[model samples]
Target: MESETKQSVYHSATYHAAGEAIMSFKPINEIHQHLCAFHVYSSDHSRHVEAHHYCKHLSKDFHQCVIYDSDDPNARLIGIEYIVSEKIFKSLPPEEKKFWHSHKYEVESGLLQLAPKSLVPGAATDIAEQPAMLELHQTYGKTIHTWAIDVYPDLPLGPPNLMMSYIGDGQGPPAEMVQARDAASGQDTAAKRELRKGYLSSYERVEAADEWAKTGRGVEFVVKEVPLKK
Candidate 1:
């Protein structure tokens, strides 16, 4: 029964953003399925959250965490919690960094605020080495900057690294143009149809990877308060 309630709140909490009437709203088992696919929970499933926007909301109640050697009995979970008062992420002092040197944990903030509906997709998932069905870029004046990140749970094995792709305005690439690219290199899929289903094309990939990393098996998942840009 407790599990059912958790699922209900997760769903209604999401519709609050879609501007759908919530008066008679109720959670459905399908809610978990959607979250599993999107890796984020937003008002509308179509919009992706941007960097500044993501930081603003997620910092309110979320945190950045690290996971250490799970095989060791004394492993720890280190939290780089949102320090609103400081306007910067608060991490354990240098001494604590020693322990954080190794581990694997993810953004623990709830879905309500971490992943917004106004930015790009794949905030927490890895991208393929091959051409993407869609290539999204942000324009800053006449210069077009491509903001891309690889969102895989298991990775190069270290701290998270941010990656970027660039395209110029006018000459900039189409956001939805698809090309042949290797998708099997990672745990995510390569199907154009499956990739483009939600608000953001690559949402399912990220969500699934995040879930597998945390539970070792696929489980309904959600994340909040992760910075879109460093």
Candidate 2:
């Protein structure tokens, strides 16, 4: 009788309605996926934090994404990334532009990928090889990581960290990290690189963001100490 009552509750209309309400929070227009790695600014480019981004095109020129540590059920909310077209990027002030990073190396080296089937259900290919990826290959991203889950492991421990993307050859995440990610995702980063070779000719690398770093005008490292509120 107890098992019957439990089954009745599980199949009740009210229970199903509650489940539908929870699913309603996902926005209907989120259509693009960007899978990539971000390096901790303070880590001297040694640690690569994986980010799985589901993005929505707010307009023809703008996009916003919420990044997760992974795509699994236990994935953690790690950060947010914003992207803009080259025209919009040029309109920004120098200081604002410094906050953004170009996607050239990320796309060309196959460091940036599309979310796998585990995350997006049917999206396991070289995102760069897709027609939509052509536009993304030209876009710029500005990302801020709020949780240092790689270092803290259990909880977010401090203020948000300014993350940066790899800029050139040999600057991307370590080979072992990429290998491990590929093993779990069942996707080949090297194969994706081969698929993107044709794109290399037409893709124009955005150098303005990196230029700011060379001039030492971008955000530099700083330490802050504060007391936690009770």
Candidate 3:
């Protein structure tokens, strides 16, 4: 027997489908690309999350992704990542720059790649294009994960945390983590690393971005006493 909650959920889902059948979701419709990468907290690189990005390309200068832990139907919507061109990253205020992390390391290192196109997770023949690599190689991302799956697995407790990318050699995710990501995604990080050699190596990095890696400083949110706005 279906529980009341389950029955209500089915009804609500049907209503949502009916609404979706008529409505034009311009933004959602615009999402055409998928990517998978690993992210670590700015304050703690040892902790990591596998980020599955279903991205919408808003413009040449900006793109944003709704991230999840996996591509499974029941995957949790972990958070979002806002990616911008180098020019846009440079335009940010000094204080604002700390939150955005650079992609050069992730790209050149082959830790980031386009997700497989087919339904099969580890199927071959899904190749990442160089054009995609070129665009992301120099971009910056501001990511924040609302759900702390690494900590409180059952709940999205605590304040949201900013995420950062590994920026240099010897600072990447653990070898085991990479292996697991590879196994799940059918990616060859080693081969990718070799193939990506000299690609975008000459692209100058935006110094202001990835401040945590640059200066060992990062931002964190904390509750404070403030009067509520009327």
- How many backbone clashes does every candidate have? 17, 0, 0
Candidate number with greatest lDDT? 3
For residues 1-230, write the lDDT of model 1, one tens digit per residue.
99999999998778776656545433322121111111111112222211211112233323222212121334232111121211121233433221111101111111111212222344333233111112110110010112211232243333322111111122112223211111111122234224334323222221211222333332112335776785
Q: Residue 44 CA error for candidate 3 (Å)?
A: 1.4
> Model 1 segments beyond 4 Å from truth?
1-52, 57-159, 162-167, 170-174, 177-230
| Residue 146, model 1, lDDT | 24
- lDDT scores in order: 0.23, 0.72, 0.84
C-alpha TM-scores of all predictions: 0.16, 0.78, 0.87
Candidate achieving higher TM-score, 1 or 3: 3
Query: Which residue pairs in model 3 clash with each other?
Result: none
**Model 2: per-residue lDDT, tens digit, 94-161?**
76877788877787777777665434332345543366567677788888888888788889877777
Better of 2 and 3 by TM-score: 3
Q: How would you order the candidates by TM-score, starting with the best? A: 3, 2, 1
